[model samples]
Target: MSDMRGEVILRVVPRPADINSNGHIFGGWVLSQMDIAGGIVAGRIAKGAVATVAIESMKFISPILLGDLVSVYAHAERRGRTSVAIRIDVVATRGGGAETVDLTSGVFTFVALDENHRPRLLPDA
Candidate 1:
């Protein structure tokens, strides 16, 4: 759906060390990846330090087992003077096949900050 404000930015397969005892990718691991991927886009827009201010509606639709390639997509859904709301989607390929199934999704809000850690004007797009 084009209306969905998300884009695939990074893709990687989890290693055995990334999995929890449940044999699925750890939630923290996935969240960190999302943060990293989300930062890439947010930084360009913010033109400075961007801090995560909020996370909403995170849903893990399926377990991501080790060796399954995971894809993370993030997009700017809303923008303000010093903040941007981003949507992140995580998907895992079932096999070596091209098909992918969404595993997690959430809205992450980031605020642009200056060197002193205060909200700053967003650089022009």
Candidate 2:
């Protein structure tokens, strides 16, 4: 939220159907977006296929509103021989884009995969 640390990987507007009973966007929906964003970065770092293996941590800072323009940001936080941990952050722009709200943040770990879908070493960086 403070000077957004990662690249904006995805930008989307929530639909009515994405809302929960509380009139806020579902947490699962936000989480999925985060995963997608993280996967993109992880795949780039791995230089091939990657699969989410774990979520090291997640925090929901605020609820997403129907009219908010959601932006997913991500960056590789750490890397191992076969896996990378991506830091993903979700922010919402509302009030005719005059306001920005910090929605959620998480660290998702992804493992590089080979053609056989088995874990593989990441490409040299």
Candidate 3:
């Protein structure tokens, strides 16, 4: 995915413990990273608290290996009365030459919430 798709929201290096028995980063770990990135973008658009309602789509394009530098990018793809769909793409930079690879991509929906924890209307963009 291009940087035009979204801003880089999160970046971190996976520790050894983050790897699965297969010697690749766990899918759940990557999913959590995407969720976090989606929530950040969604909350900013909503201008308040937001809760993840669903993962509309997800695709693991490539494996994230140990020592890979992972970066998660996200942008709001769509917005409803109280929910926003965030498209998140993850890229991994590995090896000494700084080769980049697309690792995963997903679309997640989050609902804006009021202090009462009920869904609230999203603020105007």
- Local lDDT at 66 for model 3: 93
Q: Which numbered prediction scores highest in lDDT against the true structure?
A: 2
Those runs of model 2 whose alpha carbons end farther than 4 Å from true positions after fitting are 1-4
Per-residue lDDT tens digits of candidate 3, residues 15-102? 9889898999999999999999999999999999999999989999999999888999999898999999999999999896469999
C-alpha-based local distance difference test score of model 2: 0.93
Each candidate's TM vs. the true structure? Answer: 0.89, 0.96, 0.95
Worst 10 residues of 2 by lDDT: 1-10
lDDT of each: 0.84, 0.93, 0.92
Model 1: lDDT of residue 88: 89
Ranking by lDDT: 2, 3, 1
Cα RMSD, each candidate:
1.9, 1.5, 1.3
Model 1 over residues 1-125: C-alpha lDDT tens digits?
Answer: 22473667888988889989887889999998888878878987897789988886688888888778888888987898899988888888876866778788887888999999999989888
Which candidate, 2 or 3, has the higher lDDT?
2
Model 1: CA > 4 A from native: 1-5
- Give a tens-digit lDDT track for model 2, residues 2-114: 45558999999999999999999999999999999999999899889999999999999999999999999898888999999998989999999899998999999999999
Ten residues in sequence with the least summed lDDT for candidate 3: 1-10
lDDT of 3 at 6: 81
